[model samples]
Target: MMLFCDISLAARIERAETRLIADSSDASRARRGDTLGFALPYAGGVASFAEPDSPLNKVAGLGFEGVPSPADVDRVERAYAACGAPIQVELSTLADPAVGDLLTGRGYRLVSFENVLGRTLDGFQGEPPPPGVQVRRSGDEEFGPWVDLVVDAFGHADNQGVPSHEDFPRAVVENAIRDMAATGAWRLLALRDGAFAGGASMRVTDGIAQLTGAATAPEHRRRGVQSALLSARLAAAASAGCDLAVVTTQPGSKSQQNAHRQGFSLLYTRAVLVRTA
Candidate 1:
């Protein structure tokens, strides 16, 4: 029946979402600096903390294998509290609505919604980069430049009167790069005329590759730089034996359009819940 098929599809997506979050948490833990990062596992979920001012300091990997109870939620809250940060959780509307109900009952507020998109790589193909554009794996010398390019491309502004990059220290960025490398993730850079034009990063786990932080310099917009990066990353993921590629973007945004054009389908939407300290 159609209902049965829909339920099966939803179940598959839920499983994928859980794996994505857990792998992402592990990736974050691998990137933790001495005093600025931490990841704790509790029943039915995981809590992660990055730089106090960085956007990545929050909890994910929740309700993938089982629905989280109020007690589980409290455990995660305590874990983050020990790190001196407010509790923030990312939940998929499709995975387990019960988890969202539990958080809402506990006074967490929905903060944002992100569209999770994915594509199968059974017959994957990639377009070549634009003329004079070179896509390559980033090295140690490229880490500083990589951070600069990503910050500019994303238009990340200073927060609480601190410089954007200062709030997100270079050390954290370096650790992330190193962590990705250690876990078989690819750190890619796009160069045009020997100048950095864009950057993208991806990590493959259990046959799925997550493409994240794809950004192109403002001056390089509309030049196919992002398209080139996407193509290259997809090709790389396929080569690594990944059967699926996933990305999350603001609903109906330009990024969503790009993903659609590249054959990715909108899988589901997830909202972030926050509880301020």
Candidate 2:
């Protein structure tokens, strides 16, 4: 009997380890005031802050109006400073290029790129988990683990050079949980053989169900836990009247592997462009 298992699994462990250390380092920096809070409510949408005194403001929405002003920036900064978060900024193709130029002028570094991948839920192939494993809707009791898994899956699983998992603070996690519960924005799918081996969360917005927080435990390699959880979410989404499901995955990661196996395809690749503040 060897002290280890599959080589494929060993590679994953190394990736996860690298991811964890990088994430923690980023989080420490964010906690020390290197990043900014970009989630500020405005008329019809949200404006992102790139820095404490950035000239450019980011306004994004599925569908909304109005742009950020200096006054708006001041308001958002004050709120973020009080909340102990960095100012964050966001921009989309729909957003005016002027905003980007403004941020560029102000020396705000842009980062954290991701692809907004989507596919029709119709004819998505897969079956639910095997017997002995269960998927549960989450509540307060399950929030901690859910958040932790999300942090692990994305914030600490890849070699991606992004911020740390610690950037997700109590307020951020709490708000996410509340939103998931209130709008049915998310469904937490837990796979367990009497206990959790892996899980994933799905969120639906405007007929699009987005997948996040898909993870398998260290002890449960190749046990088909993640696949089952994914299948369950797809079935649930189709039943819930979703027209399509979207997911973002790191290039060549295990989740991407699973996605291809389960019938998801690429939509677009978004690069995270960052400049240190």
Candidate 3:
């Protein structure tokens, strides 16, 4: 039996690819005055930076190796200053450890932690759905509610910094939705009873489909809305020529339990380290 884990992994990667493709063109750099640029992460150790001084910062083809040393840190800081964007690096747990320490030593604060988890789907069996709910894909008209569910689910009253002056959460989500629409990279699905209950976004890249912006409405708890959404998304990925799907979450949270229910297992645990440089 081809392990379900293989399928799970492939779907996750494809979803990520879809995001990269969807956001590549409009990956705006941090604003000229804000000293920040948009950083859209991708696989293959490839990620991009954007800002007013993007050209000088060498936004094109900046490859992440192991943890960045002081010199590398200087290079990034210089890039940020030149671009008029304050320096903030969203380093993956997989980011070079040396770089993490260097930034921490410089006083960069840790803002958030994320975990990227995966599992095989070869022999996977989905859980039963709650009563009166059904799964369906979303389009432009339904996109707004989907975005709302994500913000609400994440419990963000508003994104406090950066994006408000720069390209913040709203901008990021809007840009993503636009890109997904343009390239058909997004697979938005809703679980509801003639109303919005829960939703998810699935995009593919490099044979891996990355899942993002999944959430249930505050009023729709414990009714299998998420489970249905997950099962539907995995099936969609398989039919859409994907090899696997990867979902990232904060480790040891309710979200992890949700992933487990959907047949996703631990692929790896990534840690986020930060400092004020």
User: Which one is best on TM-score?
Assistant: 1
When sorted by lDDT, best at the front, the candidate numbers are 1, 3, 2
lDDT of 1 by residue, 129-221 (tens): 889899999886877788678766766421222121123565555454444455555789999888999988887766778786688887777
Clashes (candidate 3): 52
Off by over 4 Å in 3: 1-25, 28-72, 82-112, 123-128, 156-184
| TM-score of every candidate relative to the true structure | 0.81, 0.61, 0.66
- Native-to-model Cα distance after best TM-score fit, residue 172 in candidate 3, in Å: 6.4
Question: What are the Cα lDDT values of the candidates?
Answer: 0.69, 0.52, 0.53
Which residue window of length 10 is worst by lDDT in model 2? 1-10
Error of 3 at 46 (Å): 5.1
Root-mean-square deviation of every model: 5.1, 12.0, 6.9
Whose lDDT is greatest here? 1
Candidate 3 per-residue C-alpha lDDT over 2-31 given as tens digits, one digit per residue, 9 for 90 to 100 = 233343343344335334542543444212
After superposition, the stretches of candidate 2 with alpha carbons farther than 4 Å from their true spots are 1-39, 47-71, 81-84, 93-95, 128-183, 269-277
Sort the predicted structures by TM-score, highest score first.
Answer: 1, 3, 2
**Residues 167-198 of candidate 2: C-alpha lDDT, one tens digit per residue:** 45445443443333343346565656677566
